[model samples]
Each structure stands twice: as structure tokens, then as C-alpha cells.
Target: MPSPADTLTSDEPVGPQLATPPAISIQDLRIDYGSHLAVDNMSVDIERGVIYGLVGPNGAGKTSTFKALASLLKPTLGKIYLNGHDIVTHQRLAQANIGYMPDMAPVASDLKVWEFLDMFAGAHGLSGKEKSTRIDECIALVDLHSEYHAMCTSLSRGMMQRLVLAKTLLHRPSLLILDEPASGMDIKSRVGLRNILRNICKSHGATVLISSHILPELTEMCDEIGILHKGHLLDSGPVHDVLHRMTGLLPEIKIRLAEPPDMHWKEWLLAQEYVSNILGEDATHFSFHFEGEESDLAELLRRMITQGYLACRVSERQRSLEEILLDLEYDGH
Candidate 1:
């Protein structure tokens, strides 16, 4: 993508280039639908020049929160500030600072790629040389120059996604809010989307708030992550911090045996309170996530040996961050 830092200046006119505050800020934000409370009083601050991943199960209020940030949904309570302007009171400035993309967007089949982009540029208040330059920049940024003149209907799903993103960037908004951007994308398309997002953060100095159910992908791509459930934000922080907070002393131990274990061994292992996500290739070896004191683990192993499980070796291993996060969810229950 073209470095908007140099080519584009702040839309501010009367004053010199002023420093922007944290890209997004929410204080005691609450959203509701009729009698149903969607998002409770949740507050979060997101910095610029990085990706923030928001993950939660269905009906977790992720979409409602995003719509409020995008100014599409009115919040029943609290304040939302974008680029130092209140989203509700300073609607124009807030809108100018945000580029929001929903899970699904329209791509007119009858329009050519450049024409589609040109239409958006005009909508964003660009004209003449600036419009042409911006359209070209967006096309090249998403690597869509080859399809510059191609019809929108002829593009693939991945191509269409990239195109929608390009449309979002036409105005050079300081914040990008995306909801399930990679939904239904194939592996190749997903990878492409990831790379593009990374490039935009580093090159454009934009703040991104993205939500998805794909835990591994978010773990790999985001600088910070928030876990939400039932409209409540349970936790939010850097990836490592969130993982550590999930389990103060949790450890994953792999067990191997010289011979097969007794029929009741599996049942006994599951009956223990601190065991979960057991994985094994065969009867002789297995691993499970454990959250308990070291002495408690040893006691369980000793009991297993006495019960004829016949554990030959036990070693510790690292589990996926998502696995640990899941453990936290279960613990919350």
C-alpha cells in the first residue's frame, strides 16, 4: 500500500498537523436491544499501528460492539471516542476517522474494478488528480492492478474481499474495524488477507479492530486480544499476558506407557478436576492439559501407577494458546 503518511495529510485545515490520541477509546460503553442487553458496560483502549483481535462465541455482542464503533448502531450508554472526537457528538470527524467493513458487502457485478473504486473515491470527497491517484494506489496496494479493468462479477471470492478492503482504504481512515473478515475464505485467501492486514498496520499506521472465531489465526496476527462472552469482556491484553493470566500454574503433561492401560484408567483420568483436551495417538501414549499444583499432579500420577495404568514416562509440553484460553473459559463456568 502507498504510505499515506507522506502522500496524504490530515483532513484538518486551520491547525498544523496535531498528534492523534489512542486510535480508539471506549469508557463504560453499553449497548442494548429492546429488552435484551447485548454489550454491558465494557471499556477498552486500542493503540495505533497494530492489530487487536476480539474473539467470542456466537451472540457474544462482538458484532454489536463493532457496529457501535462504526457509528452504525447507537449505544444506549457510555462514550466512544475515535481520533479524539466523540463518536456520537462529533459524528462527522468520527466518521472521517473510521473505515468499517462488515462480514458481507456488495460488489456490483456490472461495474469494472477501477470504476467501482472511482465511485467510492468520489463518495469519500476525492476528485480529479487525487481520485485517480487514490484509485491506482488502492488497486496496486491489494495487488489488483491486473484486474484493474476486469469486471467485478468475474472476480473470485478472495479478489472480492481484497477489493472491499481497498474501498475501505480509499479515504485513508485512521481506524479499520472489521467483523469476521476471513469468514468462508479458503486457506489461500485467508493467508492473503493476513498478509495484507499486516502490511497495512506497518505501512499505514492505522489501528485495526478485528473479530473472528479462528483462534490460531488471531493469535498469530494480533498484537493484543480480548476474549468476550455473553456480552462481557472477560479478558484483554497482549497475547502472552492473556495466556499467563488464564492459568497461573497450568501445565501440559504427556504420558507414555510401556503397555496398554486398564479400561478404567481413561475414566479415572477424566474424572480428575484439572484435566482437559486429552490427545493421544494410541493406548501407550497420551497428553492432556492440566491446571493444578505440582504436588497434586504427582499424587495423581502415583495413584495411576497403583491402579495399574503403568505409566512409563511423563514429560511436560506446551499447549496452544487457544487451548489454554479454552481452559480459562471452562474454569469460568
Candidate 2:
């Protein structure tokens, strides 16, 4: 298997330029529905030409934040900027550079796929030849050429999603905000959607903010991730950096034995001075949850060796986004 570092360069173009301003920026944003706060004071910046994963549990305000960014919902407080234009003060300009897909399909079911995209292209000011060219480009971009003449209602869920994406891309927006783009998609459709998104961000220099409940899937596609919980921005940064920061207090060490250790081994692990919990266990394997400075990991390993237990494999475990979110929610209380 290739290392994470190996995957890093796969998506980046050779000699890709750097130093572009953020494509999306949010500062101390807040939103409310009646007396209930749906989005707390949150802030994040998304760089140009990168795919960012906006993740949270249901009711974590993921939809609310996306709506505000798309200018569909007016925020009660805070500001949103897209491609350097303030969304609130410069609504049209900000919106012009954004293509937003809501959590639900917004297509006219009776319209054919091509007509649906053409309608949006016209609305975005495409003229006779320009409209035809842009519509063809979008259809090819989403790999929907075969379904161009199919009625929206006759299309499968996944095809409808692709058509909607084609509609969103009609104006060639620099930034795309997709809220649960894979909600009702099958495995094949989801894979197709992800591939289309990856191509857009990689080949076209477009930035994307995609929200999803599937952590593993997001981890595979996103360049960075922002985790939200209970209306709070728990963490935001490069995926690995955020995971490292969140798990800094707990060391993830895995141990392998020559043979299956006895129950005494579990007791001995828990009794260690720095160890807090035994997170996972299996035959010939165990994971330790250690607290305090990471430098103590060496000392813990030395002690384990000195204790006469044959430790075959010992290494820190990588924290998952789900684990970080759980810790954040529990820690705040």
C-alpha cells in the first residue's frame, strides 16, 4: 500500500502554482432559527483549487453553514467571502463565482437533462453559441452525455445528481458548494460523483466544499477537513494536522506479542502509570490510550520490554475524524 505522502502528489499537477487567495472564507459566523442557534461562532478558510470536506453529524449545522455560504440563508451575524468578494455586501458578485447544490435535488423533474442544464446556462447569461458550448462542456464534465435527452424524472437517482451537478457547473463557477451530494446515491453513482468532483478540483482549478456523513469517503477525497459538532467548529486544518492535534493528549500505541497474551497483560497495561484506557484488543494485539507528552512513549516501551513481555510490534495509531469529533463533544462538557 502507498503511504499518505504518496497519495498527496497524485492529485496535484506538476508545477502547480501556489499562493492563490482563499476561494472561501468565513469569519465568526453565527446563525439562528427562532431562538435556537443552528450555527455557533465558527470560522474557516478554504484555499483555491482544493477539495475541502465539511463534515458533521446530522444537526451539526453543516446544511446551515452551506446555505449561508450560498446566500440562500441570511446569517444573523458574521460574514462570508467568496473569491475575495463579501457575500452579504456583494451578493451578485459573490454568487456569480459560486455553484451551489443543495442537500435535495432542485431540478425540474419534467425537463430533460440537457434542457435543465441549458435553462441554468441561459439564466447565467450564456448566449446562443456560448450556451450550446457550455452545456456540452458541463454534460461531458459530469459524464452525462448519454443521458442528455432523458427526462429528469426518468433518470436514476445518481443520474439526477449528475444532471444537477451539470446545472451547477453551467456558469463555470470557481467554487462549488455541494451539500450531501451522495445522499441517495448507490455505490457506483457515489464513485462517479466523487470522480467528477476530483476532476473538477484537480484539472479545472475549482475549489469545492463537500459535506457528507461518511468519514472514510471524505478522508479519501478531501485535501483538508473541518469537523463540526453541536453547532461548534471543533477543529479545522489539514486532515492529518487536525487529527494529530486532537489526539495529542492521547498516544495511540499498538503492541504485538509472540503469542496471545493472558488477561494479566490487559491488567498490567491498565496499571501503567501513564496509560488511561485500553482502547482496543484482539488476539496477539492491543492498543493503549496513553495521556500526557508523547516523549513518554519511549519510556513506556522500554518499561514494557523490561517487564519480559516479547513486544513484536509497537507503533502509534492514527486517529480517525470520528474519534476526534467524539473527543471534542465529550471534552466540551
Instruction: Name the top lDDT candidate.
Output: 1
**TM-score of every model versus the real structure:** 0.74, 0.83
How close to the true structure is residue 273 of candidate 1, measured as C-alpha lDDT? Answer: 76
Candidate 1 stretches greater than 4 Å from native: 1-20, 247-250, 254-290, 293-333
Counted clashes in each candidate structure = 0, 0
- The CA root-mean-square deviation of candidate 1, after full C-alpha superposition on the true structure, stands at 6.9
Q: Quote the lDDT for 58 in model 2.
A: 69
Residue 146 in model 2: shift from native, Å? 2.8
Best by TM-score: 2
Local accuracy of candidate 1 as per-residue lDDT tens digits, 1-333: 223432324463311123756788888889989999999989888888879998877787999999999999999999888876678866766677688988878898899999999998998889999999999988877778899999999988878888998898899877899988877677776787788788888888888999877778888989998877778888888976776565446567899987987777677898987888777769798998888777988988888888778888998765465675566467664
lDDT, candidate 2, 45-102, per-residue tens = 8889989998876688999999999998999998887876668766776776789999
RMSD of each: 6.9, 8.9
Off by over 4 Å in 2: 1-20, 247-252, 258-270, 276-283, 307-310, 322-333
